[model samples]
Target: MESHLLEVLVCPLCKSKLDHNREQQQLVCKADQLAFPIRDGIPLMLQSEAISLSSSET
Candidate 1:
């Protein structure tokens, strides 16, 4: 993702900053305990697409 685009992208639910998880290729919002998937170079920002984070991650 482009730096400018990533800068503007935030967790849809909490509107919080996201951590770029390069290995998983996802945008993680620790505050929201959600990880938005990045598939085929596209970020799936939909809430339904997010995976719940483990309690240890929060």
Candidate 2:
């Protein structure tokens, strides 16, 4: 994801800032315990597309 884009992207549910996980290719919303997928550098910000984060992952 582009730096500018990442700066503007937030969790659809909580509207909190997302942390970029480059290794996992995801944009994680810590507050919501969700991890939005990034496919080919494009973030899927939709709530339906977000995966729930496990305790260990957080």
Candidate 3:
């Protein structure tokens, strides 16, 4: 994703800033403990599509 897009993107649930995980290709919302998927270069920001973070991830 572009830097500009990442700057503007936020967690859909908590509306908090997201940290980009380049290795995992995910947008992580620490506050919500959710990892939104980045599929085919597109971010799936929907809450329903978000994956709950593991204990180690939190």
- Candidate 2 C-alpha lDDT tens digits along 8-49: 998988899999999999999999899999998789988889
TM-score of each: 0.88, 0.92, 0.92
Candidate 3: 10-residue stretch with minimal lDDT: 49-58
Worst 10 residues of 2 by lDDT: 40-49
Cα lDDT over the full model 3: 0.92
Which residue runs does candidate 2 get wrong by more than 4 Å? none
Q: Model 3, stretches more than 4 Å misplaced?
A: none
Quote the positional error of residue 9 for candidate 1 in Å.
0.2
TM-score of 2: 0.92
lDDT of each: 0.90, 0.91, 0.92
Tens digits of per-residue lDDT for model 1, 1-39:
777888999999989999888888899998988999999
lDDT of 3 by residue, 1-58 (tens): 8899999999988799999998999999999889999999999999889999976985
Better of 1 and 2 by TM-score: 2
| Winner on lDDT (1 vs 2) | 2
